[model samples]
Target chain A: MSDNITKGKMIKPENLVYTKSRVMTDNVTSYCPGCGHGTAHRIIAEVIEEMDIQSEIIGVAPVGCSVLMYDFLDLDIQQAAHGRAPAVATAIKRLMPEKFVFTYQDDGDLAAIGTAETIHACNRGENIMIVFINNGIYGMTGGQMAPTTLEGMKSSTSPYGRDVATMGNPLKMTDIVATLPGTYYVTRQSVQKPANVRKTKKAIRKALEYQKLNRGTCFIEIVSNCPSGWKMTPVESNKWMEDTMFPYYPLGDFKVPEED
Target chain B: MERELRLMKGNEAIAEAAIRAGADGYFGYPITPQSEVLEYLTMEKPHERTGMIILQAESEVAAINMVYGGAACGKKVMTSSSSPGISLKQEGITYIAGAELPCLIVNVVRGGPGLGTIQPAQSDYFQATKGGGHGDYKLIVLAPASVQEMADFVELAFDLAFKYRNPAMILSDGAIGQMMEKVWLKPQKERSREFPEWATTGKTPDRERNIITSLNLDPNKQEDFNHKLQAKYREIEKNEVLYEEFQCDDAEYLFVAYGTSARVCQKAIELAREEGIKVGLLRPITLFPFPTVIISRLADQVKGILTVEMSAGQMVEDVRLAVNGKIPVEHWGRMGGIVPTPEEAVENLKSKIIGG
Candidate 1:
């Protein structure tokens, strides 16, 4: 920040086009390069700043690569057990209804191990936001095959490639949850492009706003890329995510509340 | 100074006591021998009275994680389940304990190795007191022998849990949970709105962000935290050992027991005294603290001790450890949902300690 000013650029606060949100901490992120987690974190932080809800929100970080979310976000957080973030957020919102609560979970955490918690929390219409990152593979535990793994996608556990007959069909959590009546707003967004990042931020802001209405659950599935886990460079992974990941996990709004 | 006197099952008493104790929330899944707890809370409509939140989670795993959330907020929250359900909650329980969050867990134990029976058993002694989960952690385990104690211990468990920032458990069983007894409940306490310093409420201008988690990637820091937890456990051991002595003043032999078996041992003590036998009972109320000091002292005075329980000698291992080979310590009991009758208890005591 000082370099921009000290480098004789003299970037005034009023002249600045963009800066890191105060809702984010100075702690360095641990996510791998080209991973969507860092952008997703900053976007949520920016949304919190924009909504002025930094002091009124609680975040639950699921057991996955994003388990250290508390280290980066400048807000209160509870790290939940694998696949238990929804259940944890449910109790928080129920006990302190005035406070905003959300869970940041990954594909393996949300779709596989914590499927019951995810389904039930959404089914019960829990008034919280669920930010799911569907990379379609377990990144933290060395690229294991997740429930959302695309057919023919090769994971470490499924080195022979995901066999649709034995592995069953890829789980489309956003689509499934959108069909549930308990969900008020459900969308699938990605950050491979700048326009998509802005869309995801808007969805986050909208979800956080909708939570105050106590209508029902708001879920966002961010189709993400895992560069290191996918054995590809940042550029290659982005292209691969577009070429392979997007065909199955399309980016668009699947559910929205009726106009009031 | 007025008391709310009522005749209720131990499970019902626990539910009522939690409501009266000004608990912030109760998240639980229904399970046998303890389902009455959730049923009573739902039926009483405590939400209308104290504004406490009560939720029936989809499963025991969800129920316990819900408690983890409430505990993270530094609220008085609890859950109740049977043996099988409690087993399912082990992962969450360990996380809560490791995070050093305060919460209450009530285990109305039914028999189990693998969904064994709906009848009572003390088989979970090793699980509850010895830490059922995969980490080195301890819960303040309170053994409630009757409905009155069940009512009383709920508040006590929450108090100790918050005092030390640790999880606490009320270990009851099918017999006590099913039987009705008269209990004098305490007056209602006002719910606390003031958040604890460590609570993960929102990060205000006055404080840094509060993070409730057990994930420490650094080995040295994790070891230091473990040492700190051990220090807290040692402090709890020093202050929270609770046990009762019955006719142990001039006794030559002792029957060491807890929970349902403690009541059976009391009756057995009376029968043994009727035959001019100098036998007495020592009932441990706090199973985790284990009443080691008193038992060790009694080991010097008594000739022998017959440890009894509904399970096949789980608590006897602790008793033998407490006795420390000072005197003859033996275990006798029946398993597979069988609660040892007073006659059977007395015969086992005589044969296990006095004769055989």
Candidate 2:
């Protein structure tokens, strides 16, 4: 930021091209290199800033890589036990309906251990947002086979590669949750490139905006990359995510409200 | 409306008491013996009357976590369950304790050791007192012997829960939960919106955002939190121990009991006194603080102490620990959901200590 300012004209507030959202804290994120959690956090923080709802929003973090989200995001956060964020968010939103509540969870937390909470909270039409990060494998716990682990995807637990016969097929959770009547908006997105990042931000803004209408749950599933877990470099992981992960967990809206 | 007297089941009284006490939320699942609590709350439509939030959760596990969330906002919230259901709730209870969030939990205990029976039992004494969940923590355990106490303790439990910033439990049994009695309900209290500065009530510019969690990654930091919690428990032990004494003056023998066992012991005391045995009863209302000091003083004055219970002598161990072998201490209990009559308890005491 200082270098760019030195080379450019004396910068006035109005002339600034970009700045980090104030809702984000100064603490450096602990997510691994090429991890999507950092980008997801930035997008949400930016959305909250743009909507000026930082003071009126409460977030729930799962017991995965993003467990320390409270340290990075300048918002009130309650950490939920593995796979229970949806249930926790449901109670928070139900009690404080005027406030916006959301749960940030990963694939293992949402699609596996938390499947019941996710399904029931959505099915009950809870007025909350679910930021589901599907990175194919569990990243924090040594890259184990998650419910969304693709077939032939090798992980620490799936040393022989995920055999669909034994390991089961990867769960397409957003599709299933979208089919539920309670969900107002369901989209699968990515942030692999600059264009994708902008689109994902728009999707997040739409999800948060829907909460004001008192609609049911707004679930946005981000098909993400886990560089360290996938045993690939940051650049290689992004390319792999675009080439492999996106093909299966296609990036697009599975459900949305009718045009008003 | 002014306070009214009505005949109600213990479970029903608890529900009404919570609403009248200005509870902000009630989250629970249906369980045997205690199902009437949720049923009564739902039937009363407190949502329309007092704007209280009532949610029937997916399971005992989900219900407890919901209570955790509501409590995180520093709202007066509670849940109730039976033995197995409470067992499922232990995980969330521990988390609540670790987070130092105040909430009330009611356990209408039934026989257990794997669905033992729905009949009343005191088998959860050790589980309740010694920290049922994983982690070094304690719940201010309150034992209610009658429907009135069951109703009254709901408010008292919430008071103590917030005062200590710890979880409180109404450790009743199926007998009390199902039995009916006339209770003079307390006047309704206004719903309080005041919360501590630490509550997560959406951050304002005046204060830093509050984070409600128990996760301390650093071992030393975690240890410090544990020590702080231990200090709070010690203070509770000093100030919150409560017990009721019946015919204890000029008595030669004492009976230590709680909950329904205490009620049964009251009758046994009468039976023994008629025979000029000089027996007395000491009923512990707060079980976690265990009434240890009073029990110690009574141990020095009595010839022998008999700890009666519905389960196989769970509270007796605490009595022995408190008695410290000052006098003879013995346990008399009927397991497998058997409620020993006054005559049976008296006979057991006679044969075990007085004569044999």
Candidate 3:
């Protein structure tokens, strides 16, 4: 087998490796270079295409940069008010139970202004998916400190670093939502490397597949990187995130329905 | 079959009419006076009858956003709340208006300013007629003085909301919301078979995906959209100004009122006539358009206009603007949930207008 293989050679047409997801348009993403939102969008679009759910899915885009998710994703999308995607998704899923509804929200939109909606939706077990991108800072509004910003982290709003006593501790919202009985699947993942990206894609597919079970809410939080907001190069931000953010916001499944 | 008549509270009538009008969803929170609306919907279980979604939202803010969601999908959706609750919903309402999404909002107002009282008040008139939330926008406001109008306005509100692709509000008060009266419920109308092409229902390949949003970052584009909305509002004002004239023929004095105050003013007008004041009532059914043309015409015929309200002179400002200084315009109101009686209104008119 080794002798028959040629190194650094182009494969045959039938052996073509990877291609863009059909559900994703050719339009370039609005996300900055090296930002994790683009990878997250690709993961979702790929999952929607692989699952053949492009036609039956409606996405709720948040007020942050991902508000234009419809531009890149071919699925029908509704733009929700800041932090109101869960409430919007609840209605979309309820009114059309057969449709696959999901909300793409940021840490600021999901854990800060929308905390009530996020918690209540999970508590009610709305049969919809919520994709939360936690970048530890608000990127769209120019590096403002988010609720998920780690203690001692410096951002535009927290120029003197986050004072845990005064600014409050970093909110572990995934842990909180996982505790809600209405949630069927709750997991935290990241996409900093090729291996992590593959894992995140699998998690998204699992969430979409869980929708067929008519289970309760499925929440997937991606601990993403915002290089510009963090005042670091893409490589430096990933290294810093791996060294700092992963310890506080560890990546793993917090809750999942037991196998029968 | 003959239409069945049943005694229902104004809040209950709203819930029943929403179901009968083929509303797709009711998202609401429990508040004083208007809690009956949510309670009735939950208890009646319209989901079984017509597959209408009834969700008791965590807060008024969430309820209105849910309505925004359903409406964006081209579903006839509604939410009901009292004054304080409606205040919480203003953010979502503004978003819905900016998106031009069609939905119905019922505000059964109580004494406000700040949790003033749970009693009936028309203080929300300014908030409703003018834009309640931040934006250049208008909500088609319908004032239902009777339980029948409460029932009837459900369909009308949905119709007008979809007609203009704008939010419509039923500005009721605590008195009408809690009071029981006979209402002839309309038969269940079928939901429209033709969905809006702009709705964000899951995209089919035949058309492009729809986006419901209010985010126009470019100032110039936002300004142009604002101008377009103002033109739509102008058309609405031209076409949808509704009012009823009660004994306006040859009357020397006119009473301007709406909602519960309109009912009270009707009685006051009768008493004023008996006392030889030659008074009539101009009850505005659509408060947003303000019935300005009718009030302008009546201003020419009447010597003076006395506007009665349950608030501290809110609608009176609109009445004066409509009068355009052609005649004397005065405001008489009992604030903080103090509903003036017919005798008090008549006495106020006599002392304030006739004596002056």
The lDDT leader among the candidates is 1
Docking outcome class, model 3: medium
Over A213-255, each residue of candidate 2 has an lDDT whose tens digit, in order, gives 8989999999889999999998999999888988898999999
Find the candidate with the highest DockQ and give its number: 1
Candidate 2 residue spans exceeding 4 A from truth: A1-12
The regions of model 1 sitting more than 4 angstroms off are A1-10
Q: Which candidate wins on TM-score?
A: 1
Q: Which residue runs of candidate 3 sit more than 4 Å off their true CA positions?
A: A1-15
- What TM-score against the true fold does each predicted structure earn? 0.98, 0.98, 0.97
TM of chain B vs. native, candidate 1: 0.99
- Fraction of native A-B contacts kept, per candidate: 0.88, 0.52, 0.79
Clashing pairs in 1: none
Q: Write the per-residue lDDT of candidate 2 for residues B159-240, one digit (tens) a residue.
A: 9999999999999999999999999899998889787888776777777888989899999999999999999999999999
Please give fnat for model 2: 0.52
Model 2 CAPRI rating? medium
Residue A60 local lDDT, model 3: 98
lDDT at A258 for candidate 2? 97
Please give, for residues B1-356, the per-residue lDDT of candidate 1 as tens digits: 24799999999999999999999999989889899999999998888989999999999999999999999999999999999999999999999999999999999998878989999999999999999999889999999999999999999999999999999999999999999999999999989989899998888888899999999899999999999999999999999999999999999999999999999999999999999889889999999888999999999999999989888788889889988999999988879889999998888778878896
Order of models, best lDDT first: 1, 3, 2
